[model samples]
Target: MELTPPEFTDYDTRLGAYAVIVRDDHVLLALWDEPEVPILMWSLPGGGVELDETPAEGAVREVREETGYDVELTGLLGVETFVMAPEKRFARVGDRPQKNVQVVYEATVTGGELTHEVGGSTSEARWIPLAEVPALERIGLIRKFIG
Candidate 1:
Protein backbone atom coordinates (compact mmCIF):
# COMPACT_ATOMS: atom_id res chain seq x y z
CA MET A 1 0.00 0.00 0.00
CA GLU A 2 1.17 3.49 -0.81
CA LEU A 3 1.49 6.05 1.98
CA THR A 4 0.43 9.67 1.50
CA PRO A 5 -0.32 12.62 3.74
CA PRO A 6 -3.90 13.69 4.19
CA GLU A 7 -5.42 15.50 1.22
CA PHE A 8 -6.28 18.50 3.43
CA THR A 9 -3.48 19.66 5.75
CA ASP A 10 -3.20 22.86 7.78
CA TYR A 11 -2.54 23.84 11.36
CA ASP A 12 -5.96 25.40 11.66
CA THR A 13 -7.68 22.47 9.92
CA ARG A 14 -5.99 19.97 12.20
CA LEU A 15 -6.71 21.73 15.52
CA GLY A 16 -9.90 23.74 15.22
CA ALA A 17 -12.13 24.78 18.10
CA TYR A 18 -15.82 25.48 18.58
CA ALA A 19 -18.22 27.64 20.61
CA VAL A 20 -22.02 27.45 21.06
CA ILE A 21 -24.43 30.16 22.19
CA VAL A 22 -28.02 31.28 21.88
CA ARG A 23 -29.93 34.15 20.35
CA ASP A 24 -33.49 34.94 21.28
CA ASP A 25 -34.36 37.45 18.57
CA HIS A 26 -32.22 39.64 20.79
CA VAL A 27 -28.74 38.49 21.81
CA LEU A 28 -26.84 39.15 24.96
CA LEU A 29 -23.49 40.62 23.96
CA ALA A 30 -20.35 41.45 25.86
CA LEU A 31 -18.73 44.83 25.24
CA TRP A 32 -15.00 44.46 25.09
CA ASP A 33 -12.38 47.19 25.43
CA GLU A 34 -8.89 46.73 24.07
CA PRO A 35 -6.22 49.42 24.32
CA GLU A 36 -4.57 48.55 21.01
CA VAL A 37 -7.77 48.28 18.98
CA PRO A 38 -11.22 49.83 18.80
CA ILE A 39 -13.12 49.96 22.05
CA LEU A 40 -16.68 48.98 22.93
CA MET A 41 -17.21 46.15 20.48
CA TRP A 42 -19.86 43.49 21.01
CA SER A 43 -19.20 39.76 20.95
CA LEU A 44 -21.11 36.54 21.42
CA PRO A 45 -21.52 34.85 24.79
CA GLY A 46 -19.27 31.85 24.02
CA GLY A 47 -15.57 31.19 23.61
CA GLY A 48 -12.89 28.58 22.76
CA VAL A 49 -13.06 24.98 23.90
CA GLU A 50 -10.69 23.80 26.61
CA LEU A 51 -8.61 20.64 26.29
CA ASP A 52 -10.67 18.56 28.70
CA GLU A 53 -14.07 19.97 27.84
CA THR A 54 -16.50 19.11 25.07
CA PRO A 55 -17.67 21.85 22.72
CA ALA A 56 -21.03 22.00 24.48
CA GLU A 57 -19.40 22.16 27.89
CA GLY A 58 -17.07 24.90 26.80
CA ALA A 59 -19.95 26.85 25.35
CA VAL A 60 -21.94 26.67 28.56
CA ARG A 61 -18.92 27.56 30.66
CA GLU A 62 -17.97 30.49 28.44
CA VAL A 63 -21.48 31.85 28.35
CA ARG A 64 -21.82 31.62 32.08
CA GLU A 65 -18.46 33.16 32.69
CA GLU A 66 -18.90 35.99 30.22
CA THR A 67 -22.58 36.85 30.66
CA GLY A 68 -23.38 35.35 34.06
CA TYR A 69 -26.21 33.33 32.61
CA ASP A 70 -26.57 29.57 32.46
CA VAL A 71 -27.79 28.13 29.20
CA GLU A 72 -29.05 24.79 27.93
CA LEU A 73 -27.84 23.55 24.58
CA THR A 74 -30.75 22.86 22.32
CA GLY A 75 -29.34 22.16 18.87
CA LEU A 76 -26.50 22.95 16.54
CA LEU A 77 -26.86 26.17 14.65
CA GLY A 78 -23.89 26.03 12.26
CA VAL A 79 -20.13 25.93 11.90
CA GLU A 80 -17.95 28.84 10.81
CA THR A 81 -14.29 29.26 10.04
CA PHE A 82 -12.22 32.42 9.94
CA VAL A 83 -8.62 33.37 9.42
CA MET A 84 -7.24 35.78 11.98
CA ALA A 85 -4.00 37.55 11.19
CA PRO A 86 -1.05 37.48 13.56
CA GLU A 87 -0.40 41.20 13.35
CA LYS A 88 -3.92 42.03 14.34
CA ARG A 89 -4.46 42.65 18.03
CA PHE A 90 -6.93 40.55 19.99
CA ALA A 91 -8.42 41.04 23.43
CA ARG A 92 -6.81 37.91 24.84
CA VAL A 93 -3.50 38.22 23.02
CA GLY A 94 -2.07 41.52 21.88
CA ASP A 95 -1.12 40.13 18.46
CA ARG A 96 -1.30 36.57 17.15
CA PRO A 97 -2.34 34.65 14.08
CA GLN A 98 -5.32 32.64 15.19
CA LYS A 99 -7.59 30.52 13.03
CA ASN A 100 -10.97 29.78 14.49
CA VAL A 101 -13.52 27.07 13.80
CA GLN A 102 -16.67 27.90 15.68
CA VAL A 103 -19.51 25.44 16.03
CA VAL A 104 -22.53 27.44 17.11
CA TYR A 105 -25.52 25.97 18.86
CA GLU A 106 -29.04 27.01 19.65
CA ALA A 107 -29.38 27.48 23.39
CA THR A 108 -31.88 28.68 25.95
CA VAL A 109 -31.33 30.65 29.11
CA THR A 110 -31.70 28.11 31.88
CA GLY A 111 -30.81 29.91 35.11
CA GLY A 112 -28.78 32.64 36.80
CA GLU A 113 -29.17 36.38 36.60
CA LEU A 114 -27.86 38.48 33.74
CA THR A 115 -24.86 40.06 35.38
CA HIS A 116 -21.28 40.51 34.33
CA GLU A 117 -18.91 38.10 36.04
CA VAL A 118 -15.81 39.56 37.60
CA GLY A 119 -12.39 39.04 35.96
CA GLY A 120 -13.86 38.35 32.56
CA SER A 121 -12.97 39.80 29.18
CA THR A 122 -16.32 41.53 28.79
CA SER A 123 -17.04 44.80 30.53
CA GLU A 124 -20.79 44.83 30.17
CA ALA A 125 -23.57 42.49 29.02
CA ARG A 126 -26.80 43.55 27.40
CA TRP A 127 -29.56 41.94 25.42
CA ILE A 128 -29.64 43.74 22.10
CA PRO A 129 -32.34 43.12 19.57
CA LEU A 130 -31.19 41.40 16.41
CA ALA A 131 -32.54 44.28 14.32
CA GLU A 132 -30.12 46.62 16.05
CA VAL A 133 -27.18 44.26 15.72
CA PRO A 134 -26.13 45.61 12.34
CA ALA A 135 -25.62 49.08 13.73
CA LEU A 136 -23.39 47.82 16.51
CA GLU A 137 -19.70 47.14 15.99
CA ARG A 138 -19.40 43.35 16.25
CA ILE A 139 -17.51 40.40 14.86
CA GLY A 140 -18.67 39.03 11.50
CA LEU A 141 -19.18 35.53 12.88
CA ILE A 142 -21.41 36.83 15.65
CA ARG A 143 -23.54 38.67 13.12
CA LYS A 144 -23.88 35.48 11.11
CA PHE A 145 -24.97 33.61 14.22
CA ILE A 146 -27.54 36.25 15.04
CA GLY A 147 -28.86 36.16 11.50
Candidate 2:
Protein backbone atom coordinates (compact mmCIF):
# COMPACT_ATOMS: atom_id res chain seq x y z
CA MET A 1 0.00 0.00 0.00
CA GLU A 2 1.06 3.55 -0.72
CA LEU A 3 1.43 5.93 2.21
CA THR A 4 2.13 9.62 2.38
CA PRO A 5 5.30 10.88 3.97
CA PRO A 6 4.78 12.03 7.55
CA GLU A 7 6.20 15.38 6.57
CA PHE A 8 8.30 17.18 4.03
CA THR A 9 11.91 16.24 4.66
CA ASP A 10 15.17 15.18 3.03
CA TYR A 11 14.77 11.57 4.12
CA ASP A 12 11.49 9.97 3.12
CA THR A 13 11.79 6.43 4.38
CA ARG A 14 12.38 4.64 7.66
CA LEU A 15 12.93 1.04 8.71
CA GLY A 16 12.40 -0.70 12.06
CA ALA A 17 13.41 -3.90 13.83
CA TYR A 18 11.53 -5.99 16.40
CA ALA A 19 11.87 -9.27 18.28
CA VAL A 20 9.32 -11.62 19.92
CA ILE A 21 10.89 -13.50 22.80
CA VAL A 22 8.83 -16.23 24.40
CA ARG A 23 9.78 -18.63 27.16
CA ASP A 24 7.42 -21.13 28.72
CA ASP A 25 4.15 -19.24 29.27
CA HIS A 26 5.80 -15.85 29.62
CA VAL A 27 7.09 -13.30 27.15
CA LEU A 28 9.73 -10.64 27.65
CA LEU A 29 8.79 -7.05 26.86
CA ALA A 30 10.31 -3.60 26.98
CA LEU A 31 8.41 -0.55 28.12
CA TRP A 32 9.43 2.90 27.01
CA ASP A 33 8.32 6.34 25.99
CA GLU A 34 8.51 7.74 22.47
CA PRO A 35 9.04 11.44 22.95
CA GLU A 36 7.04 12.28 19.87
CA VAL A 37 4.11 10.07 20.84
CA PRO A 38 1.67 11.00 23.58
CA ILE A 39 1.39 7.59 25.33
CA LEU A 40 3.79 5.19 26.99
CA MET A 41 4.05 1.86 25.19
CA TRP A 42 5.41 -1.65 25.59
CA SER A 43 6.99 -3.67 22.83
CA LEU A 44 9.61 -6.27 22.04
CA PRO A 45 13.27 -5.34 22.49
CA GLY A 46 14.68 -4.33 19.12
CA GLY A 47 15.73 -1.39 16.98
CA GLY A 48 16.82 -0.44 13.50
CA VAL A 49 18.93 -2.90 11.50
CA GLU A 50 22.15 -1.10 10.68
CA LEU A 51 23.30 -0.76 7.06
CA ASP A 52 25.92 -3.53 7.13
CA GLU A 53 24.09 -5.92 9.44
CA THR A 54 21.62 -8.65 8.62
CA PRO A 55 18.23 -8.62 10.33
CA ALA A 56 19.15 -11.55 12.55
CA GLU A 57 22.43 -9.88 13.53
CA GLY A 58 20.64 -6.62 14.21
CA ALA A 59 17.99 -8.40 16.29
CA VAL A 60 20.63 -9.92 18.52
CA ARG A 61 22.48 -6.64 18.89
CA GLU A 62 19.37 -4.59 19.54
CA VAL A 63 18.03 -6.97 22.18
CA ARG A 64 21.34 -6.77 23.96
CA GLU A 65 21.53 -3.01 23.68
CA GLU A 66 17.97 -2.33 24.79
CA THR A 67 17.44 -5.08 27.33
CA GLY A 68 20.96 -6.09 28.32
CA TYR A 69 20.14 -9.63 27.29
CA ASP A 70 21.44 -11.98 24.64
CA VAL A 71 19.05 -13.69 22.24
CA GLU A 72 19.05 -16.34 19.58
CA LEU A 73 16.81 -15.57 16.64
CA THR A 74 14.79 -18.65 15.78
CA GLY A 75 12.72 -17.45 12.89
CA LEU A 76 10.74 -14.65 11.35
CA LEU A 77 7.35 -13.75 12.76
CA GLY A 78 6.28 -11.29 10.07
CA VAL A 79 6.49 -7.67 8.95
CA GLU A 80 4.29 -4.64 9.41
CA THR A 81 4.32 -1.19 7.87
CA PHE A 82 3.37 1.89 9.82
CA VAL A 83 2.68 5.34 8.46
CA MET A 84 3.56 8.17 10.80
CA ALA A 85 1.87 11.51 10.64
CA PRO A 86 3.90 14.67 10.87
CA GLU A 87 3.09 15.18 14.51
CA LYS A 88 4.12 11.62 15.33
CA ARG A 89 7.57 11.88 13.81
CA PHE A 90 10.33 11.85 16.44
CA ALA A 91 13.33 13.37 14.81
CA ARG A 92 16.63 12.03 16.01
CA VAL A 93 19.40 13.97 14.26
CA GLY A 94 17.94 15.05 10.93
CA ASP A 95 14.69 16.11 9.35
CA ARG A 96 12.86 13.13 7.87
CA PRO A 97 9.44 11.59 7.47
CA GLN A 98 8.54 9.49 10.47
CA LYS A 99 7.40 6.34 8.72
CA ASN A 100 8.72 2.85 9.35
CA VAL A 101 8.68 -0.67 7.99
CA GLN A 102 9.14 -3.07 10.91
CA VAL A 103 10.59 -6.55 10.68
CA VAL A 104 9.54 -8.83 13.51
CA TYR A 105 11.23 -12.05 14.58
CA GLU A 106 10.77 -14.90 17.02
CA ALA A 107 13.68 -15.37 19.38
CA THR A 108 14.84 -17.17 22.47
CA VAL A 109 16.54 -15.45 25.36
CA THR A 110 19.92 -17.11 25.58
CA GLY A 111 21.46 -15.25 28.50
CA GLY A 112 21.78 -12.09 30.59
CA GLU A 113 20.69 -10.60 33.88
CA LEU A 114 17.60 -8.45 34.18
CA THR A 115 18.74 -4.93 34.86
CA HIS A 116 17.43 -1.47 34.10
CA GLU A 117 19.68 1.14 32.58
CA VAL A 118 19.13 4.84 33.04
CA GLY A 119 18.63 7.18 30.11
CA GLY A 120 17.95 4.35 27.70
CA SER A 121 15.32 3.75 25.10
CA THR A 122 13.58 1.27 27.39
CA SER A 123 12.66 2.14 30.92
CA GLU A 124 12.22 -1.48 31.94
CA ALA A 125 12.56 -5.02 30.66
CA ARG A 126 10.77 -7.89 32.30
CA TRP A 127 8.86 -11.06 31.71
CA ILE A 128 5.10 -10.85 31.85
CA PRO A 129 2.86 -13.89 32.27
CA LEU A 130 1.68 -14.84 28.83
CA ALA A 131 -1.92 -14.98 29.93
CA GLU A 132 -1.64 -11.72 31.77
CA VAL A 133 -0.16 -10.03 28.74
CA PRO A 134 -3.50 -9.57 27.03
CA ALA A 135 -4.77 -7.47 29.91
CA LEU A 136 -1.67 -5.33 30.06
CA GLU A 137 -1.25 -2.39 27.69
CA ARG A 138 0.99 -3.39 24.77
CA ILE A 139 1.42 -3.15 21.07
CA GLY A 140 -1.29 -5.14 19.28
CA LEU A 141 1.31 -6.94 17.20
CA ILE A 142 2.73 -8.54 20.35
CA ARG A 143 -0.52 -10.37 21.03
CA LYS A 144 -0.62 -11.57 17.46
CA PHE A 145 2.91 -12.90 17.72
CA ILE A 146 2.01 -14.86 20.84
CA GLY A 147 -1.05 -16.40 19.28
Candidate 3:
Protein backbone atom coordinates (compact mmCIF):
# COMPACT_ATOMS: atom_id res chain seq x y z
CA MET A 1 0.00 0.00 0.00
CA GLU A 2 3.00 2.30 0.34
CA LEU A 3 3.55 3.21 -3.25
CA THR A 4 0.05 4.11 -2.86
CA PRO A 5 1.29 5.32 1.24
CA PRO A 6 3.47 3.47 4.15
CA GLU A 7 4.98 0.41 4.54
CA PHE A 8 1.74 -1.48 5.43
CA THR A 9 1.06 -1.84 9.12
CA ASP A 10 0.51 -5.24 10.66
CA TYR A 11 -2.10 -3.80 13.00
CA ASP A 12 -5.80 -4.06 12.31
CA THR A 13 -6.01 -0.33 11.61
CA ARG A 14 -4.03 1.83 9.19
CA LEU A 15 -3.70 5.61 8.96
CA GLY A 16 -2.45 7.29 5.76
CA ALA A 17 -1.73 10.80 4.57
CA TYR A 18 -2.14 12.00 1.00
CA ALA A 19 -1.37 15.15 -0.92
CA VAL A 20 -3.16 16.96 -3.72
CA ILE A 21 -0.67 18.92 -5.82
CA VAL A 22 -2.34 20.83 -8.63
CA ARG A 23 -0.24 23.27 -10.57
CA ASP A 24 -0.77 25.06 -13.87
CA ASP A 25 -3.83 22.97 -14.59
CA HIS A 26 -1.86 19.77 -14.03
CA VAL A 27 -2.06 17.42 -11.07
CA LEU A 28 0.73 15.17 -9.85
CA LEU A 29 -0.05 11.47 -9.57
CA ALA A 30 1.65 8.17 -8.93
CA LEU A 31 1.06 4.86 -10.62
CA TRP A 32 0.63 2.44 -7.74
CA ASP A 33 2.13 -0.93 -8.67
CA GLU A 34 2.30 -2.88 -5.48
CA PRO A 35 2.09 -6.57 -6.48
CA GLU A 36 0.63 -7.98 -3.26
CA VAL A 37 -2.11 -5.36 -3.00
CA PRO A 38 -5.13 -6.26 -5.07
CA ILE A 39 -6.00 -2.81 -6.36
CA LEU A 40 -3.74 -1.12 -8.89
CA MET A 41 -4.78 2.39 -9.74
CA TRP A 42 -3.51 5.87 -10.41
CA SER A 43 -3.55 7.42 -6.94
CA LEU A 44 -2.70 10.69 -5.27
CA PRO A 45 0.92 10.90 -4.05
CA GLY A 46 0.80 9.74 -0.44
CA GLY A 47 1.21 6.75 1.89
CA GLY A 48 0.80 5.48 5.45
CA VAL A 49 1.73 7.81 8.31
CA GLU A 50 4.71 6.45 10.17
CA LEU A 51 4.58 6.00 13.93
CA ASP A 52 6.88 8.93 14.50
CA GLU A 53 5.54 11.32 11.84
CA THR A 54 2.61 13.70 11.98
CA PRO A 55 -0.03 13.54 9.28
CA ALA A 56 1.42 16.64 7.60
CA GLU A 57 4.95 15.26 7.67
CA GLY A 58 3.76 11.94 6.37
CA ALA A 59 1.97 13.60 3.47
CA VAL A 60 5.03 15.62 2.51
CA ARG A 61 7.31 12.60 2.64
CA GLU A 62 4.96 10.38 0.69
CA VAL A 63 4.57 13.04 -1.98
CA ARG A 64 8.31 13.19 -2.44
CA GLU A 65 8.69 9.44 -2.53
CA GLU A 66 5.86 8.87 -5.00
CA THR A 67 5.82 12.03 -7.12
CA GLY A 68 9.26 13.56 -6.73
CA TYR A 69 7.94 16.83 -5.42
CA ASP A 70 8.68 18.77 -2.27
CA VAL A 71 5.28 19.94 -1.21
CA GLU A 72 4.36 22.23 1.63
CA LEU A 73 0.97 21.29 2.90
CA THR A 74 -1.34 24.29 2.88
CA GLY A 75 -4.49 22.97 4.50
CA LEU A 76 -6.50 19.84 4.98
CA LEU A 77 -9.19 19.00 2.46
CA GLY A 78 -10.82 16.28 4.56
CA VAL A 79 -10.40 12.82 5.96
CA GLU A 80 -11.68 9.74 4.25
CA THR A 81 -12.21 6.34 5.75
CA PHE A 82 -13.24 2.84 4.80
CA VAL A 83 -13.77 -0.42 6.59
CA MET A 84 -12.72 -3.60 4.87
CA ALA A 85 -14.24 -6.79 6.09
CA PRO A 86 -12.15 -9.74 7.10
CA GLU A 87 -12.85 -11.54 3.85
CA LYS A 88 -11.65 -8.55 1.83
CA ARG A 89 -8.54 -7.89 3.88
CA PHE A 90 -5.55 -10.03 2.88
CA ALA A 91 -5.20 -11.44 6.38
CA ARG A 92 -6.52 -10.65 9.80
CA VAL A 93 -4.05 -9.33 12.31
CA GLY A 94 -6.13 -8.16 15.25
CA ASP A 95 -9.69 -7.14 14.46
CA ARG A 96 -12.57 -8.47 12.45
CA PRO A 97 -12.59 -5.51 10.08
CA GLN A 98 -9.66 -3.55 8.82
CA LYS A 99 -10.14 0.17 9.29
CA ASN A 100 -8.42 2.61 6.98
CA VAL A 101 -8.28 6.27 7.96
CA GLN A 102 -6.86 8.68 5.38
CA VAL A 103 -5.96 12.31 5.77
CA VAL A 104 -5.70 14.30 2.55
CA TYR A 105 -3.99 17.68 2.45
CA GLU A 106 -3.80 20.53 -0.03
CA ALA A 107 -0.24 21.43 -0.95
CA THR A 108 2.05 23.54 -3.12
CA VAL A 109 5.26 22.32 -4.73
CA THR A 110 8.24 24.08 -3.20
CA GLY A 111 11.11 22.03 -4.66
CA GLY A 112 12.28 18.82 -6.33
CA GLU A 113 11.91 17.56 -9.91
CA LEU A 114 9.66 14.94 -11.38
CA THR A 115 11.13 11.47 -11.12
CA HIS A 116 9.80 7.94 -11.24
CA GLU A 117 10.44 6.15 -8.00
CA VAL A 118 12.78 3.17 -8.26
CA GLY A 119 12.35 -0.13 -6.40
CA GLY A 120 9.13 1.03 -4.79
CA SER A 121 5.46 0.29 -5.05
CA THR A 122 4.99 3.36 -7.24
CA SER A 123 6.54 2.57 -10.59
CA GLU A 124 5.99 5.95 -12.27
CA ALA A 125 4.97 9.52 -11.60
CA ARG A 126 3.47 12.15 -13.89
CA TRP A 127 1.51 15.38 -14.04
CA ILE A 128 -1.76 14.79 -15.79
CA PRO A 129 -3.93 17.51 -17.21
CA LEU A 130 -7.02 18.23 -15.17
CA ALA A 131 -9.22 18.09 -18.25
CA GLU A 132 -8.20 14.51 -18.92
CA VAL A 133 -8.94 13.10 -15.52
CA PRO A 134 -12.43 11.80 -16.19
CA ALA A 135 -11.12 9.67 -19.00
CA LEU A 136 -8.33 8.10 -17.02
CA GLU A 137 -8.47 5.09 -14.76
CA ARG A 138 -7.79 6.41 -11.27
CA ILE A 139 -8.52 5.87 -7.63
CA GLY A 140 -11.55 7.40 -5.94
CA LEU A 141 -9.44 9.75 -3.81
CA ILE A 142 -8.37 11.55 -7.02
CA ARG A 143 -11.87 12.92 -7.42
CA LYS A 144 -11.11 15.37 -4.59
CA PHE A 145 -8.18 16.89 -6.48
CA ILE A 146 -9.57 17.00 -9.99
CA GLY A 147 -12.72 18.57 -11.29
**Model 2 alpha-carbon drift over 4 Å, by segment:** 1-11, 92-96
- For candidate 1, write residues 1-147 as lDDT tens digits: 999887863324212222344456777787765456566788777766888888888888888887788888888878787776756525345444567778777778889988985766677888888789889988766768765
Clashes of each: 2, 0, 4
Q: Among these predicted structures, which one has the highest lDDT?
A: 3
Q: After superposition, how far is residue 52 of candidate 1 from its true place, in Å?
A: 0.5
Alpha-carbon TM-score of each model against the true structure: 0.76, 0.81, 0.84
Query: Candidate 1: global Cα-lDDT?
Result: 0.71
RMSD (CA, angstroms), candidate 2? 5.9
- In model 2, which range of ten residues has the least summed lDDT? 88-97
Candidate 3 residue 125 C-alpha distance from true site, Å? 0.7
Alpha carbon deviation, residue 9, candidate 2 (Å): 9.7
Model 2, backbone clash pairs (residues 3+ apart or across chains), number: 0
Sorting all predicted structures by lDDT, with the top scorer first, yields: 3, 2, 1
Off by over 4 Å in 3: 1-11, 37-39, 90-95
